[model samples]
Target: MLAIECAGLTKHFGDLTAVDHVSFEVEKGERFGLLGPNGAGKTTTIRMLTTVIPPDEGTAKVLGFDVRRKPDKVREKIGVVLQGLALEFFSTVYDTLDIYGRIYKMNAENRKKRIEYLLSEFELEDKRNERIDCLSGGLQRRVQVATAFMQPPEILFLDEPTIGLDPQSRRKIWQFIEEFSKGGYTVILSTHYMDEADYLCSRIGIIDYGKISALDTPEGLKSTLGGGDIITFGVEGNVDLLRSTISKLDYVEEIMAGDELAARVENADEVLFKLSEEVVKAGAKIKNISVRKPSLEDTFIKLTGRRIE
Candidate 1:
């Protein structure tokens, strides 16, 4: 079953079109990623799906309820941890979760049981009575996540959940998200981290200029760039001449030269032989040569002319 679906979804703010005819589906119990650079409409799309804002055009359905017509029903079935910290520093960790439980209308007995489970699971039992402002950033994030899970909704939407976290804290949060998905909950996250998307998302949608430029598994997306071999070499003489020589090779698809020349070739061995003979014949000394598979960042660069950072 699809936990989330959007068709020709669009949003605009005055003259700015934040989202433009974007469409995608996320299946139940799946880990999906929304990847894009800043101002690419990822946050706007999240707001529309979570029913925090209405889309100006098209439609969206979350957990089978139309976001426009039945936002209340949709909200009941999903958990949201937005980019900004939503917690009140004056509230204790225990009180924070309790407030959410009350908002969900959980009975007193069920709420207490759920709180106990969450505190223990998140390792926050010891910090329950401590004020939110007194905890470390990581612990506070843990509290945020724990509060979201208090109701155990079927789907969770996290927007840059680990942003500004230390490396150790980020890894811990990733682990928590993975474990959360294992319990039969669908997880949809939007992040600017390429490695995070590659690591956690079963499938990723790459958005740019307020539209989806590509969508697929990480490996599948990389494969679309036409895999062969990429070789970079520095030649001691006119870099332009080196570029011209490498571009003339039959096996070479592209030759890019800066301080060095990087060539894309179908047959690395044949291209290397040709390049060696040509450079020697042209009296240019070869400095270095290395071949490598294209990374996700490479693919992004090829498609959008920008890096994900």
Candidate 2:
């Protein structure tokens, strides 16, 4: 069954259109991602699908229930971990989770077993007695996510779940998501981190300016950029001249400008040698140079004409 079906979904904030005519489908057991930088409408799309806010136009259905007409039914089958940390600050880790289980109408015995299991799984067993305020930001996030699973809803909506987290914390969250997805659950995650989307999502919809610019699997999206390696030159000066100069190179297929000007080029030693020589003549000094395979970031850059930060 399709986990989500959205067509021409739009949301407007007065003068500005937050989500403009967006459409996509997510299948059961799939890890789907809405990828873009902040203010790109990733969060807005999640809000509409989760029935947190009604869409200004178009339609959205979650697990076959229309979000606008059957919001309660939709909520019954989904779990939401929003951008904000929605945990009780004064409660201990154990009480926080146990209370949520109670809210979900779980039996006493079931709550105990489930809480124990979650504590162990989330590595919170040692921190069970500690107050949530005493835990680190990462642990608090982990606790917040655990609460969403109290009901063990069919679908989970994660909006930049690891935004403020450290690298280690982020990896742990990714691992948890990977583990949960193994049980055939559907997860729709929104993120601006290229590696996060590329690693966790089965297919990604690249959102820019509140619209999906492109939607494809990570490898599929990279393949669309064709056979090329991204050669980035850290230009010290005259970047504009360097961009214009590199665009004319016979071996350079496409170029993108940013802090470090990057080019998608045919991977050959001759191409690299000449590209460096041309950069110098263009009055730019190459502070650093690196060559790597084309990635989802490259695909995004090509689509939106800039890099995501």
Highest lDDT against the true fold, candidate: 2
Candidate 2 segments whose C-alpha is farther than 4 A from its true place: 268-270
- Write one digit per residue (lDDT tens) for candidate 1, span 1-309: 999999999998999999999999999999999889888999999999999999998989998999999999998899999888889899999999999999889999999999998898778899999999999988888888788888877999999888888887788778888998999899999998988999999999999988999999999998886887778776688878778876877778766323456777777876677767777787788887787776676677777876665
Candidate closest to the true structure, highest TM-score: 2
TM-score of each: 0.85, 0.95
Model 1 weakest lDDT span, ten residues long: 254-263
Q: What is the lDDT of candidate 1?
A: 0.86
Clashes of each: 0, 0
Tell me the spans in candidate 1 whose CA falls farther than 4 Å from its real position. Answer: 229-248, 251-291
Model 2: per-residue Cα lDDT over 1-309, one tens digit each: 999999999999999999999999999999999999889999999999999999999999999999999999998899999998988899999999999889788999999999998898888999999999999988999999888877777999999989889888788889988988899999999999999999999999999999999999999998988977888888789777678777987788887645667888878455888888888888887889998998888888888987887
lDDT of each: 0.86, 0.90
lDDT of 2 at 124: 93
